[model samples]
Every structure is written in structure tokens, then in C-alpha cells.
Target: MMREILSFCALTALLLTGCTMAPPYSRPEAPIPQDWPSGPAYKDAFSKPDAALAVEVQWRKFFNDHRLQTVIAMALKNNRDLRVAALNVEKARALYRVQRAELFPTLETGISAKKERVKISGTQGMVNLEEYSINLGISSWEIDFFGRIRSLKKRALEEYLASEQGRRSAEILLISEVANAYLTLAADRENLKLARSTLETQQAAYNLIRRRFEVGFAPELDLRQVQTRVDTARVDVARYTELTAQDENALHLLAGSPIPADLLPRELSLVKPLPDVSPGTSSEVLLRRPDILQAEHVLKAANANIGAARAAFFPRISLTSAIGTASGDLSGLFETGSFVWSYAPRIVLPIFDARTRPALEATQVARKIALAQYERSIQIAFRETADALASRGTLGDRMAAQQSLVDATARTYQLSNARYEKGIDIYLNVLDAQRSLYAAQQGLIAIRLAKLVNQVRLYEVLGGGGDASTSPEGL
Candidate 1:
């Protein structure tokens, strides 16, 4: 009988293994257009057929600078937030394994001894009784005829995938953040250097005017005007110095370790430019972004949950069985002809459960919510990529125009100072020219920094990172 029961259970499980009560799942249509938006903002955008996809480009190749690559590596290894994300992925994986294991019966083995007192029916006296047995069998294992357990397993698998994608997103964001902080520090340092240089020039002019006043060749007013320029430059130098220090602190936090002095950026001009990336002609690239993929996985998990909820309305079948050897004496427990077995199959059909309908409705609503969230993620990615492309369109022109202004102002300053020496103009003219040149130089530095930071933003939004191979689903 025990052998027959085991054969029946195996056959039943095999027959129901492929059955599922859940609705068929299909990916919803993307709510956005196939091609990227085009307007004045995206005028300069272009794509190359031979260029690698933004998602496939390695961070090391994109960054170019050896020092920055080193810092990013450090952050990936030690950043606390990223570490927590990785841990979460592991936790989700374990949970999925636990759920999947439910599809199979758990086999258990044990030895037992029993002692009890039983009252005699006729003698009105109590007698001791003892028995021993050894058993190996399954207990209360659900038979998934309705696919309820399988649906729950599927949901767990999708959730695990979603968690993995989330970890990748966190890693990409951290890399971009580190690069931005490093660039900021370099820009501030350059600004500080420019201010100090301007202050020295103004101080020298002030000294010259003071000497002329003492000799009765220049007035006190001319000396005071040059002194004002010196003081203004002094103020800027102090401000930029403070900013550079703060930038370093921010970089340190991202790196999660002290940066080597030699590895730190000294000036924006010295930092190498990031490699160019194509947005491709299609906006579908956004689907490959880690965050978007994570959202889609969440949607899949929700869909699977709906199937589990549907399965709940059907009959639930469970099997409990044991086969072993038993005897009144412990020494004879495993002897031949002492074999014993039991099989108890149970079924639970929901007759009047008030929560079943509401539970199914809740799962359907949850799936709709996940669908909306997935579409929203795609929209947000499109906007971010569009904004970055827009900045790219005009930054080159801005840089060129800024450089021209700096050159023009420098010429004006030199000419004004020469005219004042020859008594062709008032000393006030030279003071004004000096101020214009200093301001123009500052503007050029700012434009350069913007151009570089924009490149980083574009790469980040396009999901540029080198860690994982592209998913076969193309997301």
C-alpha cells in the first residue's frame, strides 16, 4: 500500500506541474514614441551606426582619466549605500529560493519511542504501554493542482529580478555622482587660481599709482580706484577657496575614503573630457536603463500575484503520508513483517469565504498600479535624456562666445593702461577695463565647467555603465 501511494503522488504531481490558473501575461505597450523628440534643443544630436550603445559602454572607457576610474572602483567596492543595495539583492534571491522550494515535497526522517498509560476496559486498572518506530515520509505537503504554489513562486522570481536591477541602478548613479563631485572640485580650484592672479595684477597697479601720487604725478583718487579692484579680487579668492575645500569634502564622502593628493584634479583644463555617446535615433534606449527595467520587473511580479490570487478560489489539496517499521519492542522495530504505513489525503474547497473576491480585486488593482508606475518610469527617462541633449546642442556655441569675450576684454585692458600712461585717457578708464577683463575670465571658467558636467549627465541618464551584460529581453 505504501509503494502504491508513493507512485500515485508522483503521477499526480507530474500531471499538474504544467497547469496554471493565472491569466496570460503580455507586456503593455510603451506609452511614449519610438523615436526621440526633435526640436531646436536637439538640433545638434546625431547617431553613429558603429558606435557602441550607451548601456554597453564601460565606465572606464567613457571616463578616460585613470584617476577618476580608480575613484569609481573604490566607490563601487566600499560606498555604504551601494553595499546595502547589493545586500538587498542577496536577500531577495534567498526569498525566491525559499518560495520555489515549495513546489517539491520536503522529505523528513526520524526515530521515536513512546510510553503511555491506558485504562483496561474490563479490569478497571491502568496498564503501561510502549512502542517504537522509525519513519521517513512527507507531512502536509500541498499538491499544487490549481497552480497556486507555482504562481507564488513565479512572483518571487520576478521580485528577485527587480531587486537585482535596482542594485545596478544604484551603482550607476553612484559612479556619476563621484565623477560630478570630482569635476566640481577641479572647477573651484581653477576659479581660485584665476582670482589670485587677478588680485596680484591689481595690487601691482595700486602700488604704481601710490608712487605717482607721492611724486605729484597721479591723484589720490586714481590710487583708491585701483585699490578697490584689489579688494574685490581678494574677496573672490576667499570665496573660491572655501568652495574648493567643500568640494573636496563632498568627493571624499562619495569615494568613502581619502583621495590621494596626486590623484585630485588641480584644474578643469587638466581633466580629460568624457567620451562622446550617441542617444541613437530611438527613444527605446530608455527601456535598457536599470531603473526602467526594475519597474518592468515589478510589473511582472504583480501580474504573477494576480494569478496566485485567482488560484485561491479553487480547491486546495494536501498530502500527508508516512511509511516505516514498527514493533512493541524497541529491538524489533526494524524487523521484517513489522512494516506499517499511512496515507491521508485532504481537500479544502472554499464554500463561503468573504475575503476571496476582495482579495482578487485587490491584486487586479495592484497590477494596474504597477503598470502605471512602469510607464511613468519610461516617461521620466525620456525627459532626462531630452534635457541632456538640449544642453549639448548649445554648449559649444556658448563656450566659443565666452572665449571671444575674454580675448576682447584682455586687449581692451592693455590698450586702456597704455593710454593712461601716455595721458591719452583718465586713470578711471584703465580701472574699468581691468574689472571687465577679470569678470570675462570668470565667465569663461563657468562655461567650461558646465560643458563638462553636461556630458556626465547625458551618460548617466542614458544608463551608461559596464557592470552587467545586456539582458536577453533587450531591457
Candidate 2:
């Protein structure tokens, strides 16, 4: 009958402990436009929004260069920053588990032995006592009568989720950075090649003019002008060489290890542009961006904290109970008559503490701060997507114009060279034409690189090339 009564009381206590003081959660509305920007700047880029394009495009599919793909993979595997972000996620998960464990009793078992002697005066009597016991016990486990433990557990879970989203954000940023660095290195190499070829051409021209002057066929002025052009081209060669080396160093740093020479692009002239990405109209896609999602998680955690603070106004209840056996003789510890048990229930009421009210106020303020941060994240995402789209709209037109300029300049240079050979024009005209052609060619390369880089930026701001449901590594 006694055992049955004890079981009934335990069940009642469990049933009464499930209420929570937390307020209902609703996601804050985004503070940006529902649709992407419209007008001349965005018309060509977002002409028809493919709502599913961003979700479907993966980084590998977007970047077709085998070399570039390999470098990105290496960075993902070896970058120190990304490794730290992944570790942070694991740390937050373990902390959540620790907070969650408070909801359940922790059972512990131990053996104890003691010996004591007492001496009395007068008639003289001395007694020695030995005691031995073994027990299993629960120590000071919170019963959570007012939902304090439950609220804290919910807060911890939200924080863990926030850390996971943070890791995803770091991964996305790293992928974008690696792609940008790779593209920069390729552009620098192409520039270096152009500069070296121009220097050789100028040197050949200078030698021809010097021979003409020596043989009385060309004047000293013509030889001097050609020599100046040669000197300028030499300077360009040196500058470009330095830039290429520096670019390689930057790329190596991003990769976090030395990249094999064969894995780098000898030239990016044949590389294809990244595919276009569509930003959906509902601004719902922004929700999938890891940074925005992380902000929301932090806001949710703050909300849970408010609940915990509110619960502090009520009494906190905890339970400490044990059921085991005790005996004077170690061999008899497990005997039926040696059974022993204890149940302790404690409650703490906050009567006059000065800190409780202020603590609650602090949580309230933190929740407001979180809400503001969440809204700001949405605003920044909208602006970045708009900027990328604007750049995409006009880059194609700019590249076309630059190609025409290069063609026209090349024809002018060829005509001027023929005139100089036939003695119809001075060598100064030939020098001017050559310089114009070289500048146009270099400009064309810059425009092409810009077009390609903008595509990558578009992919990044549109929440990366992969689905938000999975990470770059599919972790």
C-alpha cells in the first residue's frame, strides 16, 4: 500500500510540471520590397523571374572550369576559417545537450564506510562503532514547476540552430571568396602575357628604326620616338609581372595550401560566363540565406529568454530523492530489511532580491535588439541582390562595345604600319596606332573579366549557387 502511494505521488508531481510561461512565436515581417527592382537597369537582367533557378543551380554546375572547381573543393576541405565555424556548431550542440539534461534526474551510486570511537569517564566505558552503506541517489534535480528549465532548454536549442546556420553562412562566404580569387589570378596572368608580347613587338620596331637611321633611310627623330615606346612597353612588362606574382600569392592564401601549377588556368580567354540567377519575387528566398536565418534564430532565443525571466517571479521547485540499502555489515547491505530511501523537495521563492526585475528588463531589451537585427539583415540582402542584378543588366552590352573598339584599333594599327613601310607617313603615326591597339586589347580583356566576375557575384548574393536545404559540402 505504501509503495503504491509513493508511485501515485511521483506521477502527480510529473504531471503538474509541464506548463510554460513563454509567449507565442511569430516571425517578424521582412522590411524590404516584395518584388525585385524594376526599370532599365534591372529590365534585361530580371526580365522573367525564374522562381526556382536559385534553388536549382549548384556551384559545380555554374562554374564549368575543371581547374576552378578543383581549387574550390580544396579550399572547402582545408580552409582554417571554415573549420573553425564547423567546430563552433559542434560546441553549441554540446552546450544545448547539457542544458537539456537538467530536465531529467541524474542518478548516482556510491559505497561509504566509517569508524568512530567514544570514551566516557567515571565507571569507564569505551565504545567503537562501524557503519557500512551503499545507495543510489538523485541530487538536486530541478522539477521545473514554473517552466524555468523548459524555457532555458528551448533557448539553448535555438542557439544551437543559430550556430549551425552561422556555419552555413561561413561556407557560402568562403566559396564566393575562393571563386573571386581564382578569377583574379587568371585575369592577372592574361594581362602579364599581353604585356610581354607588347614589349617584344616594340623591341622589334625599335631595332628596325635604329637600322634605318644608321643607313640614312630614317631620321634620328623617328628612332628616338620608337625607342621611347619600347621603354614604356618594358615598364608595363615589369609592372604586370609583379602583379601576377602577387595574385598567385593571394590565391594560395585563400586555398590554405599550395596549389599545383597544373590546376591553375593558363588563360581564361575560353572560359564561359556563369549562368544567370533569378531572384524570386516574394522575398521568401531571403529567408533561406544563412545569415538571415541565423538572425531569426537569435531572435527566437531572445524570446525564450524572456519566458525564463518571467518564470523567475514564481517559486522554483527541485527534487532530490534516493532509494538504496544500508547495513552495519557489508555482506547484509542488500538484505530485504536493510532497504533505505529518502525524498527531498525544495522550493525557492524570490521575496526581496533587487536583481530580478532588472534581469527581466535586460532580456526584454535584448529581444528588441534581436528584432532590429533581423530586420536589418533582410534590408542588406535586398540591396545586394539589386546591385548584382543591375551590374548583370549592362555587362553584356559593355563587353560588345569593347570588342568593337578592339577591332577598329587593330585595323588602324595595320594601316599605319603599311604607311610607315611605304614612306607615306612618319614613324610617330605608327607608334600612336600601336599604342592605341594595345590599350584597346587590354581594355577588352578587362571588360570580359568584369562580365564573368559579376555573374559570380550574382550567384553569391542570390544565396549561393546551391540549395539552402543542403550545405556546399552537403553536411
Candidate 3:
């Protein structure tokens, strides 16, 4: 009879699993475009199926600066924010392990020994007895045929992958920041050099005027004007020197070490040009960017949760069974005659749920929200890619023009100094030319750094987070 009852209960659990609304999850269909939106043609010739798409490029390698690479390496190793991101990957992995463990049965074992002395009422005498028992149990949660637990485990794994991708994204950003900061410091050093050189040149002219005044070939007014030019140049040089120091300090912080100036890059010389972004192929960033990968995992988790929510509407099945012996005397425990066993299957059906419908609605809405976030993430990636590509084109043109201006200003400054020395122009004219040259020089430095920074931004915008195969630290 007991066997028949247990068999019927198993059959009943299977029928309940079938009756529940456990829908199979599917990704919504999206319109896959054949080409990029802008005028980016693929190679202008037959290409071997996106040879560049084979692997995500290492941004550090692209910079090709050993100093920059070292700084980024240190930052990746020791930066606090990046460490926090790495820790999150471990948390996600633990969550995944917990979910995975749910797919298997659980076992519990128990043992107890007690001693009691009591007075017997109504029949007259005091009695003392010792009792002992031991139990072993094996139980399981019914997955039935609904695959609810399976979906949950799948969601957890996706989330774990997502966390790992997030860590990669952090790494990319940290490396980019270190490279950019190093570049910026190098530019500042150049500006300082230019300022000092200009100051010394003006001082030489001032000395020439002072000598002429002492020999009566120049007036006191001429000497004063030349002295003013020299003093002003010295002031500007000092200002830039201070700024250069600040930039160096910032570079040190970014690199996670205080590198000596001699050890650091001190002049802008490398030709790491900004990337020529093409925005190549629609939604490619979605597959490439790490943050996007993480977002999609979140969406997958939400979808899996929908099945989990729907499963709540049906009966829940859990089994518990035990084999044990109980005896009035401690010596009788586990004896030949002491044997007992019990098994139970629990089924809880929601017969009159007062608030369950709303709960299901909430999960449904949550799924929609996750889907919306995922879609929005894709749209944002596209927009960022477009913006980076457009800026790359625009900045390239602007920097070319700015470079010309820098060259022109230097030529003008040189001519103005020569004319002043030959008495064809005033000292004020030479000073004004120097100022123009300085401004143009600084502006060019800014633009150059912008171009370099944008190259890194383009890579980040492309969503190139690595896959699950990349191991998380302390995992």
C-alpha cells in the first residue's frame, strides 16, 4: 500500500509540473543589418572575413610604450577600484555554485542521546531511564519535468560570466587612463621646455639692450621695454613648470607608483595616433564590449526568473526519508532488533493565493525592465560608437589645422624677434608674437592628447570584454 501511495504521489508531481506555465525562453528577434551605418566600406576589397575580428586587441600593446605598459600593469594589479570589480566576479561565481548545487539531492544525518529520571504517578514508583537514537537521511527536491531549477542555474551562470566581463571592462578603462595620463604628462613637459627656451631667448635680447643703454646706443625706455619682455617670459615659464609638476604627480598616482621624472616619459615623441574608427558593422559593439556582455547576462537572468516565477503557481514537491533506530536503553541502540524507517513527500499547492497574482505580475514587469535595459544598452553602444567615429574624423581634421597654426606661429615669432633686433620692430611686437606662439603650442598639445584619448575611448565603446574562459582572481 505504501509503495502504491508513493508511486501515485510521484505521478501526481509530474502532472503538476506539466500543468504549470513554464514557458521556454527565447531571445527576441532583432533586425541584423548587413553593414555599418556610416560610409565605412569593408577593406575596399575582398577581406578574409574580418581578420581584425579574430580577437580583441590589447590596448596596452597598441600604445607600444614600455613605460606606459608598466604603469598600466601596476594599475591593473593594485588599483583599488579594479580590485573591487575583481571581487564582484567571485561573488557572482559563488552565487552560481549555490544555484548549481540545487540540481542534486541533499542528505542529512542525525544522532541523539538523552538521559532522564522521573517519578511515576498513579502506579507508584520512581523510575530512571536512558534513551538513545541514531538516524541517517537522504532527501531530494523534485525538479519534475518543469526545468525551473535548471533555468535558475543557467541564470546564475550567466550572471557569473557577466561579472567577469565587468572586471575586464574595468581593466580596459584603468589601462586607458594610465596611458592617457602618461601622454598628458609628456605633453606638459614639452610645454615647459618651450616656455624655458622662450624665456632664455628674451633674456638674451634684454641683455643686448642693457649693454647698448650702458654704452649710450639705447635709451632708458628701450631698456625698460626689453626688460619687461624678458620678465614676462620668465613668469610664463615658471607657471608652466608648476603645471608640469602637477601633471607628473597625477601620472604617478595613476601608475600606482612615484616614478622619477628621468624614469618617466618626459617629451611628447610617440606617434600613437587616435584610431580611425569606422563604426564597422551594426551591433558589433554589442558582441565586443564587456559592459554590454554583462548587461545581456542580466537580461538572460531576468528571462530565466520568469520561468522561476511561473513555477511558483504550481504545487511544490520535496521528499524526505530517514532510516534509524530508537531504544529505551542506550545499549539497545543499533541492536539486532532495533530498526525503523519513515519517508514523506510534501506537496504544497496554491489553492487560494491572496497576493500571488501581483507577485507574478511584478516578475513579468521585472523581466520587461531587464529586457529594456538590455536594449537600451545596445542603443547606447551604437550611439557611442557613432560619436567616437565622427569625433575621430573631425579631430583628425582639426588637429591637422592646429598643427599648421603651431608651425605658422613659430615662424612668425622668429621673424618678429629678428625684426626687433634689427630695429625694424618694437619690443612689444616681439612679445606679442611670443605669446601667440605659446598659445598655439599649448593648444596643439591639448589636441594631440585628445586624439590619443579618443583612440582608447573607441575601443571601450566597442564592447570588447573577454569571455568566461578568462579566470577571475581569487576564484
- By TM-score, the best candidate is 1
Between candidates 1 and 3, name the one with more favorable TM-score. Answer: 1
Model 2 error, position 336 (Å): 2.9
Listed per model in order, the count of residue pairs whose N, CA or C atoms clash below 3 Å is 0, 0, 5
Where does candidate 2 have its weakest 10-residue lDDT segment?
466-475
lDDT of 2: 0.83
lDDT-best of 1 and 3: 1
Per-model TM-score versus the true fold: 0.95, 0.93, 0.83
Off by over 4 Å in 3: 1-23, 28-55, 118-123, 139-148, 213-232, 260-263, 270-279, 464-475
Better of 1 and 2 by lDDT: 1
- Top-lDDT structure, candidate number: 1
| Steric clash pairs (candidate 2) | none
User: For model 2, what is the error of residue 74's alpha carbon versus the real structure, in angstroms, after optimal superposition?
Assistant: 0.6
| Candidate 1 pairs with clashing backbones | none
Residue-wise C-alpha lDDT for candidate 3, range 220-322, written one tens digit per residue? 8878877777787788788878877888787777666677555577777554443233344445545557776677778777777777777777777777778
Q: Give the TM-score of candidate 3.
A: 0.83
| Ordered list by lDDT, greatest first | 1, 2, 3
Model 2 lDDT per residue over 1-475, tens place: 4896589569747744676788888998888888778888876787656534665678888887888899989888889999999999989888888888887778999789887887856646887767888879889887777788888988988888888888878877888888888887788788889988988998998898899889999999998998888888889889988887888887788788999999877766856557667776666777888888889999999999998999999887787877788887778888789988888889888898788899999999999999999999999988988898888888768888989999998999999999999989988999999999999988988887887888788777777754444232322
Candidate 2: Cα lDDT at 376: 94
